[model samples]
Target: MAGRESLPLRRLKLFQPLNRLTDDQLILLASRAERRTHSPGQKVVERGVRDGMDYFLVAGTVELKAGDGRTSKIEAGGEKALTAVARLQPRMYDVVAVASCDFLVVEQDILNQMLRDAPLIQADLDSMVDETSGGTDEHRLLMEFYAELRSNQVSLPSVPDVAWKVRRTADRENSTAEEVASAITADPSIAAKLVRACNSPLYRGFNDVRNVREAVIRLGTRTTRQLVTVFAMREVFSTKQPFLQKSIDALWKHSREVAALSWVLADRATRIDPDEALLAGLLHDIGAVPVLVHAEHYARLFADANLLDHALGELKSDVGAAILEAWSFPATFVEVARHAEDWQYECRQDLPQLVDVVQVAQLHAMIAAQQNADLPQFEDVPAYRRLGGLELNASRSLQMLTEARARVDEVHRLLAIH
Candidate 1:
């Protein structure tokens, strides 16, 4: 696996779309690429072992592991981020040799420089991928592809630009529909999408929206801005985390259900905007994505353990807060997402309406989603009893549940899902 046969394993997902598709030039550069060899069962790169330079797998297989002793991803070049992370703080996932292997080691800066000529490399990858098929070695190629998709300068997705702009303008007292329209119009796709959503049953306008300005006026400044943020949120919510699709999807469903229930409950509970509560509910568990997505270890930890350990409890809230804080989300929303479900050790009696709103909303969503089977009884928690204690009495709780379902329907329909 030596000579000039080494290549940087740039998977299609890692490549910025701005580069278009360039795989051929990469293969060309890879042809003259330098190779580093390792004996079978040797450590190519260990977790927490930082190296500034990055390596491309020219040959062989490796397995990725995390701090928790769980195997991360099982591939060769897919395990190289430990070295890349050396450029930062403590390394994330660790890399280990699965068999005898060769790597085309490239400095991080050099790879960045080459990305300017992405079109050529994209072509090479396209061909290489086409030639690759599932069997013995094809598994390696797929794993590499999975890892590459996770690669990027930002390392995480951000809010949509169209939604962000509208929200920024909505901050001021002098903001107008015209201003919001001007912002969203920059992205025609987003503009059209927003108009459609505003006209949907959630907003409940009889007339169809023909333009952004009119839609903005009809939806109001706060609602309009919120809608934009929700639309932008899909990128973060919809990512395919490594080997954790089912887990990710379950979180999404839970969040979405909570969001819907919260919207309805908000109307019943307070003068607060229903939509605001929905937004809060939807994003409450948002932090877990980055934890599971970036770390790669959380999957194994959750999967193997039949019990939900207390140590892992902080993780969901901690990651949730981190995500919202990074997004510059409102402080109140951040608090709810970061702490609602967990048993806060320092809390006293008489739970406030807001905390109770979040706690109850989460519980209702879980029960409705059938995620409560494994969880303990709702009445056991003091806070749970405080929020009308889940009494199915035909008056207050039933009304909340009914309205919650209706609002949940609105959210699902707005997203065009069942």
Candidate 2:
């Protein structure tokens, strides 16, 4: 039997969703996960079969074939192999070993259950902290908070009604810009902001637009939907507790910067819609909101910044994914929320994805803020390479950002909450 110590936990952390797990949860996962091997030409997974398992390539190579004859290769130790081979259930592809291959096989149910129980596990661990040693009782407080979060007692923020209405109006078959404009008008503040944004350098035209209806017509329904959501996102970052306001403000600022960078990168380097990329960047760190909300109940945790940061770092990705999922966001935005921080994450697609744009944008934001000391080299990041035309050296990357400073500030000013 494979024990926790026998599993390659470090390498496993490179995988998505798994990268979001807490250290204790990873230990539990390692114990249940098993190692397997396949000889060259062996079938690793069959198309259209429900195997109830996820296969992570650990060594050698495998080829994934679709019914239509489309194929792709994943090589061990490469960024592409960091995620499961054909992750969808009732497998979308038939995976065959191209060389002798080593794999880490995790039962899907076990992994799901572990993820579901993560908050409870953290709560239990915090409950064990000794309180009599004059230490802060944040552990006990957090344990209670985590228990509430696990039980859904802690309310996750709802998608603002105006944003939801705009999405619904835009997504309806045959919906017009006029109908979407009506949705925006329900929240006059967002309506005004949308019109104002349309005039900003990010979307400026030869002539200025004066109203929500004209703004919607100029921006198109899809861009209007996204901008409405972006404009409304500020309300989600609020905190009633004065002590937590600074952290909330900082998070909002960081998200705006990343959103701005994502917009510029997508507009310049990829075919992805700049507005969609902007939305992805804005919501990437939204998971931190619930964590901060919970922490407000335990004011002492604020005194120990590391403890709060650790909690936010460990829990935000999963929480953000859940929040977006509940809001009916497309899979791409949900993916950005879940894996944008997975610096080594590589998409299966040949082209850059919204997540890739947001990831590179985040790195740029960090670099600009002088927080790149611990980040991966720009040239080595898979997302950076996928971006193609951009120069990847630190000086060159900084130069690109420098060139875009005016546009970035325009976006930031457009989206920043007053």
Best by TM-score: 2
TM-score of each: 0.56, 0.69
Q: Which ten residues in a row have the lowest lDDT in candidate 2?
A: 124-133
**Cα lDDT tens digits for candidate 1, 142-189:** 333223332333244455777667777887679878988899889776
Deviating ranges (above 4 Å) for candidate 2: 1-151, 389-395
Give the alpha-carbon lDDT of every model.
Answer: 0.58, 0.78
Q: lDDT per residue, candidate 2, 1-418, as tens digits?
A: 1223335568768876676477888887888888888999999999999878888788899988867555667798764565666765667688999999888888877776565555424443344333322344544465455444433345688888899889878888899878888989989899889988898877889999999999999999988989999988999998888877889999998999999999888877788998899999999999899888887777664556755775676678767876775565776887898788888888888878998899999998998799888899877888888785544455755677789889888888888644
Which residue pairs collide in model 2, if any? none
RMSD after Cα superposition, model 2: 9.1
Best by lDDT: 2
Worst 10-residue lDDT window, candidate 1: 80-89
lDDT of 2 at 317: 78
